[model samples]
Target: MTTPQWAWAFEAADGTPVEGTVSPVFTNRFDAEQWLGQGWREMAETGIASAVLLAEGKVAAPAVRLSSDV
Candidate 1:
């Protein structure tokens, strides 16, 4: 079996994928969440309106709004 790959998928307010946003692939969900915790503010400022955790290229969690007004 292959190990699961965890990452965040970022999107704009209109639901399109954010251009130039690259999430670092993680070995576990914890690491992926931790990274988001630290980087979400920056992401929000950089046009990322929301994000969702992805595991093995599938959504692993509900989408999280990065912008407070979103």
Candidate 2:
């Protein structure tokens, strides 16, 4: 079975919406979600965009693009 991949969406510090440019990041599938619970929480703090960690071809932890003010 094809393993799921992970991606980190980079964006400006401001709360402006940005285009998610998915690219090669982690070589190991496990590293894709290396952060575990901490990853999602970290992304939420950023607020510019999301850092999605996928597993079993599904989004296990998806950090939405929240307002930076948060």
Candidate 3:
């Protein structure tokens, strides 16, 4: 079987992918979430309004609002 691909999908307030933002890929969900827990604030500061966990290019969880204003 193929291994699952885990990654973060970041978006702007309007629901479009953030320009210049690259999603960091992980081998598992735990690591992906851990990284987000540590770096979400920085992502919000950089115009990322929301984030979604993706597994195999599909949504694994609901979008999380990063910016309070969004």
The better candidate by TM-score, 2 or 3, is 3
Compose the digit string of candidate 3's lDDT tens values, residues 1-70.
9888899888999999987888888989999999999999999998999999999999999998999877
Count the clashes in each prediction: 0, 0, 0
* lDDT by residue (tens digit), candidate 2, 1-70: 6544555554544534356544355546566555434455555564544444444345556454433443
What is the lDDT, from 0 to 100, of the residue 17 in candidate 1? 94
RMSD of each: 0.9, 5.7, 0.9
Task: Please report the TM-score between candidate 2 and the true structure.
Answer: 0.34
Which digits, one per residue and each the tens of the lDDT, describe model 1 over residues 1-70? 8888998889999889988889999999999999999988999999899999999999999999999757
Assess every candidate by TM-score.
0.92, 0.34, 0.92
CA deviation > 4 Å runs, candidate 2: 1-6, 10-24, 52-70
lDDT of each: 0.92, 0.48, 0.92
List pairs with backbone clashes in candidate 1: none
Model 2 has an lDDT value of 0.48
Candidate 1 lDDT at 58 equals: 95
Q: How displaced is residue 38 in candidate 2, in Å?
A: 2.7
